[model samples]
Target: MACKCGGYYYTLNVKASFDRDLNKRRKFLLRNVSVIRMFTSGFFRSKWRSIAGKRRILRLKALTVSLKALKLAGVHGIGIEVWWGIVERFSPFDYDWSLYEELFKLVSDSGLKLHVALSFHSNIHSNNGKGALSLPLWILEIGDVNKDIYYRDQHGFSNNDYLTLGVDHIPLLSGRTALQCYEDFMLSFVNKFESFIGSVIEEISIGLGPSGELRYPAHPFGDGRWKFPGIGEFQCYDKMDDLKMAACREGKPQWGDKGPQNAGCYNSVPSGVPFFEEGKENFLSDYGRFFLEWYSGRLICHADAILAKAAKILKKYQEREQTSVMLVAKIGGIYWWYQTLSHPAELTAGYYNTALRDGYDPVVSVLSRHGAALHIP
Candidate 1:
């Protein structure tokens, strides 16, 4: 097929080209041909056949493929991922923009948008900090190893010394102060990419860590600990209190008010610390915390925050340019979604039922309407 632009014509070959000038040509192909094929692949060929069910499943698959391809090609807005340790490593006034810059540049050059997984721990930091994916070992000196305690708990999971020191639990506190450091990192992120972010990037996903066995005890609410339902509930350690005081007294803090907000937090929910129990039942009992937290907190609250922030920022940015980008949140796993994360199957099933009650399908539909898709396994 071919499309006419004014007086010129361009060929439309599904596999051969998408460079046509008229957006209609591409849109037509996607609606008619691409969607039908995807539907057939899942519905007709598969034994689980029901006309209505097939239609729904087909729409879902088409949507999934379309969204993934669009984000990858930059046709869509952007997709986000998390990389927490990076920000924390140079937090409190400094930043390492190289990692993000590289990613942004590649996306920009390709005419695609970007969404950043702001910050979180990675395998490099997980495997004693010497593995292929480890953060540049230098962060050990920069980041307060003490705060790294978030990694270890009775849950048998280890996010800190286990990676850097080659052992599971090792107390080595000493790095930047807390709130100041965290704010510094966030500010640096927002500032460094201030121009490129809302302009070129679509969303930013802040990871709380995975819901796997390696992480537990850090559950934000259900199990207590650092449960901050609102800024008022936050426990102000000496450093955090000092920062608030300094910001209030000096009148120079970047974060307005220099204090916590009434907005709730979802960090304490899933520890992402692993459980090394030998039996499946024990593992389920331990890992169940993550499954529940993922459904209740991570997918609901944390994901909502990312989307709301992205929408607010992107909308304001677009107001000037008269162009709006979609806000796609990189959310956590579902019941089945966590199987790959090594969550117990029973826990996964339980989460699935919870998802049904929580209106997960509708949430995904809402995201689709907004030019976004909540990730699933």
Candidate 2:
């Protein structure tokens, strides 16, 4: 039975101080870039799918009227996800911005600002394709040829939610690295929406990893493969050799090729869990320290690579716009594992946070270098 439970819903669509003048609106949108969850302008909402559900968004007339209402209600503007799957569904570098362009026009005519999320991941895992978008067909075709492009866990459970960081620089997507592909896609977006770059489009939420959050698809919900409260596993195994080589060079040759097995299976609790409980073989051990550091470090490297390219691209646009265009990156759902000393869940999910160390500091430092506002929903 499909649940038609629809009533009031939360939306990131909050109207900033309304400006009737066109130029004034542009400046306001550009200068104010703290766009965050539910009216931050950079939209980081989750409780509600969107103000206009997928079905209504598909209707042009409905979407047009929706924008008008938003403007009337004093909503500064709206943020929409430009899904890679739909835009570049046909081929590489081939983008069709017809729909979004029309949508942008509606916002403009209604005197509202806009922020676009350069969404790169599929929404399949969240709702099992209940009005969800899939990855680009062509890219998935390549994944068929090389499965490692997607994150595969030890139990051989493959999460096709996002591309693994291990293959970020490696050329697997038709002679182009994943990073290159993303760059190309973003470049195409800026070019396509050049008119709205500085004016209406004030902020861009860059999708760093799965579901646009900076984390591995360790405990994925797609197909119900992983249950909640379960310690997830390491993803992007292609980078294992690099970690192994580093370990060997660090006078820990025995650690080569052996990832952390102390992490219990999905649904394992903190108490009595080997790697989770603070004990001899737990995260307090010497081996644990090294492994977790390396694990989180790799994640940061991936963020640095993507955000470096993204920052460069946005900076050029910002210069052209002659206004401060805010760039945002999402790192949502910080775990509150106060019960476990080792924090096995965070360790497996690529966060080395525990009683001893702050795993997020280094990651935040990297984001700071790029001037990206972290959106925590």
Candidate 3:
């Protein structure tokens, strides 16, 4: 067990069992208790009233009284966001899984343990602050706004001014990409719940960036018909980040010969930079550590193709239910904006040394090579 928040650090693992005929009748029979500490939220926004059109009903006794008040407040786990614009809202390989089969049978009859965020963008916001376009309006009426498919920033804004979906026009309108439609929507949502993803679905956050958290969209909002004010820049000027900064300046020629024209290297102390004056090295802290190692190697190649398509659909449901399943990749933390500036001018800030060498150690070293797990609120 381990814990530490606001700076990040969480590790928990528990296992226990007993009862071999009560240990030869000595009389102490506790059997099977394994807890991988997880207590999430997002509760369930009722698909945000089906993206505001309303009438999507599914009040199973108010969702079994809110999963029996999160199993009497112990809350083993619950995170559910699964809204890809209300499960393929109005076509594109049609799908509806009837409100995730009644919220996974009321979260497996309230025994809890289910964490799925898959939400293809839109972390909600709107009240005038923006963000709230959970995509799917026919993927912005069949996209292609000149290929860079959204995400512009550097004052130009884009991402159609908030909400989400435009992570390169979702793999160019599904002809595949956007990590192959997130590994075909996690192998059609684990083959449409093959026995509750082989036993009460444990985790699968994988939302990958912008609110769902990874990076980019450090604030966007431009075409919801204009309305701006501080915040809204980082998005590394699209065109696949200008062909990955022209292949990282063709083998790093001091990242010069002209490259970054906008994506404003997260403003590393601009305005006559001279903070850590004695020897200089700023240039937006070396292009924000080469744009956070090229955006954490393109989000670790889309989290290794979404855990290799969720390990080939959890290996055909663990070869017809022999049991034993595990597929993680929650990832979503990164907020250190130089510990909120100010102090000897935040000790000559470079945005906390570009969030510890380009945003949280290159996204926790490429999501720890794949076992991935992080949710720092």
Q: Which has the greatest lDDT?
A: 2
Per-residue lDDT tens digits of candidate 3, residues 1-377?
00010122132210011111223212111111112344644334433245344324445577678777867877666666676766775657676766677667777887876656676665443324342445555565654444355566545545632222335335566575565666666678777877776467755556665555544455333234222322223454555454444455657655533333432233343333332222234323555445434544555555455555655656555355444444444443332333432111212111222322222333333444444454544
Residues forming the 10-long window of minimal summed lDDT in candidate 1: 1-10
Q: Write down the lDDT that model 3 would get.
A: 0.47
Measured against the true structure, the TM-scores of the candidates, in listed sequence, are: 0.40, 0.83, 0.30
Task: State the lDDT at 45 in candidate 3.
Answer: 44
How high is the CA lDDT of each candidate model? 0.34, 0.69, 0.47
lDDT by residue for model 1 (1-377), tens: 00000111111232122123425533444332211001001111111112532211224354345445554643444443434444334433345455455445645655555545544344542333342133324445433443333333323233332222111122232343322232344556766777775567644444333421112222333233333321112222212123334444445454323222221232322233232123343234423333243323322332343344444444555355433333333323323222133232212222222212222333333343333433322
Model 3 TM-score (2 dp): 0.30
**In candidate 2, residue 33 scores what lDDT?**
33
lDDT of 3 at 129: 37
**Model 1 alpha-carbon drift over 4 Å, by segment:** 1-91, 125-148, 151-156, 161-184, 211-315, 318-321, 334-373
lDDT at residue 11 of model 1 (Cα atoms): 17
Residue pairs in candidate 3 whose N, alpha carbon or C atoms collide under 3 angstroms: 132-163, 133-163
**Order of models, best TM-score first:** 2, 1, 3
Query: Clash number for every model?
Result: 27, 6, 2
